[model samples]
Target: MIYQSFSSIANAGEETCLNCSTHVVWIAVSIDGGISFTDYQVYIKPDVTVGYGHQFVNVSVDQAGSVYLVYNDNHNMFYSYSTTFGQSWNGPFRINSSPSNTAIFPWSSAGPAGTLDVVWYGSSYYDGVNPPDSYPMTASWQVYFAQNLAATTPNSKWSQTTASGIVHYGGVCESGVTCTGNRDLLDDFGVAASPTTGFATIIYTSDQYVNSANEPAQPFGSGGGCTQSSTNSVECSHTDIAVQTGGTSLLSATTKHHFQITKTDFEQISNNPSLTIQVTNIGNEAINALTAQISGLPLNLPWTPALSLQPGQITTATTGALPATLLLAVGTIYTVTITANLSDGTTETQTVSAIYTLGAGIGL
Candidate 1:
């Protein structure tokens, strides 16, 4: 199957203004390996300004067929995922770790199941928030990368780092042909992981300073011979690639530390309520040790006994019984977190929550 994403402009007038125009993201799924698409849907409607919001929309599918879509809006990167073949999506989660840096041209690539890598042009000085009509972009840009090893989990953590040196030192107007300032780096870049090595390779455009002599020069705006004004300099237009040197490999046949957690209530034992927590190794890899912890109850329980779980194995452990006399405040919620320690020296967690009512049973 193939997943594709693109952007569309809405509420356009004969002459568009920054606030008047809006941008949206659309997605399509192809079962025949991109030969033809049967389902086309609009995932996100026009919410932000048309210029930067919907630019550089990209999509990638993981080994398990989960689709990931990423885009930039308001100088920030947003990501969403779909597992049911584009029938529904999880979020428009902000993936950029940096709050102040400007993120643009976000591109994504899925590696192993639940693993994803994203690359974009990030700038320290330019937040890309100024009015479009007034050219307001000015800053130094670099290739920034972020990865989520457990992307399928809720509130997954993303690790971010700088992938390359300064690529450009100026304002980047993403306002298409009507851009007023520098649009030198163009629009988007690309990222992909090697199936064999599992390392990510990023292909991007660079405008870093390089003298006509084909050697390193000073910084772009620092009176460098290869400044943007010197259009003749080769540094003004060049393509470069960055390869991951040290990191976890994205290529794993078995889903790395992937599991599912389910909590079920058992009948009252000795007039005390009891709960059963089950964990299933849904991935191909076997979990070396599995444990669970429960919180938000009258009494919190520590980690449960470790259990080895093989692929497709489901194991259950009982939680401490709660006495009927114990008083739980209104709207009391119980949280169960299941953790899996993989054989590869990595750990993953899945959590479930249940709310307790006065007379009614626990609702998950």
Candidate 2:
């Protein structure tokens, strides 16, 4: 777990706060999947030059179990990672491609081995208001995204892009619960990767112009899906999802073939033996033809007639009734290989294990 807190001192064996200037991010690890956590350790403590210290500390763990840490320090986004869970870290790398006057509320999601995606609110101009201000931040802000396909590598180049249109025309205060200005955006938004496409999907809030007059919404004054009237002046905030259109996928596919085994069925009968496999096309492109064959049974099943499958479609290949001599042993484990041929001229292979029982059907 990660948190932000003021600095502390050991005053006669009692911990004492040392003022807000020493604010820092603390981290605690739970080896047992969060059942319990280790003692908190100071993770990030920015220098006095940045002032006000770091806020909104976030973390993400990749497929390889590397943990990524992100936070906003003096209007800039910074990140670090630990291959050792939280034991050791290896970064202080910057996330934004260009310098920004204000960047805050950073959130990150990890994907396939060594890939990570981050999103945060940012603006080219700084409103110049210190936290806990009575007014809202006045700088126009938009959601920004930074992706690193080789995140495990130190200082890997990050691909930066704008994730959303200007979300707000005014400034966003970073001083949670303290500043009174335009806190409609709250503190943070989040981002995640698509399981099949590997693309980054970000969910954020927006208060867009609602009526034809282009009136901004409430907090910005009577706009956004509202009827700009004395009684009906409140406009609802929008929860939006930004999908990445072009970029290297977080789902890193080593093979061009993008199909997956969805289901498999096996039957061990004396005279009516059958085995079927289901494959789903998960890629953006359609498969003109697909065929499959299974091996490791008493008799290897021959490849079935080639069939076509559209993107996101699931199709089945079956080895219909075979000769009675093609018997399967009950209570015996069998590791089977399924090879699929795609029209794209790529062949994909997968393996599965199955066991048959006298009454219970064959389990795959």
| lDDT on C-alpha atoms for all candidate structures | 0.63, 0.60
- All candidates: CA RMSD (Å): 13.5, 10.8
Looking at model 2, residue 254 earns an lDDT score of 29
lDDT string, candidate 1, 40-150, tens digits: 444445454443343567888775556788877646788888765565687778787663267877888987567899988876654345632232335567899988888
lDDT of 2 by residue, 1-364 (tens): 2222232221223224334343344456643234455544434454423432433677787644567878776567877776654666776788885544567788899875567898888777644555322224355678998888888789888888788777766545566777555566665489988867788888887655453343344443444243334221115455567888876777654235466655555555443445666666766656665433334434334323345667778776667543455456643434455555566677666655433322222221
- Single out the weakest 10-residue window by summed lDDT for candidate 1: 355-364
| Candidate 1 clash pair list | 137-171
lDDT of 1 at 83: 64
lDDT of 2: 0.60
Q: How many backbone clashes does every candidate have?
A: 1, 7
List of clashing residue pairs for candidate 2: 135-181, 136-181, 137-171, 138-171, 139-171, 210-224, 217-223
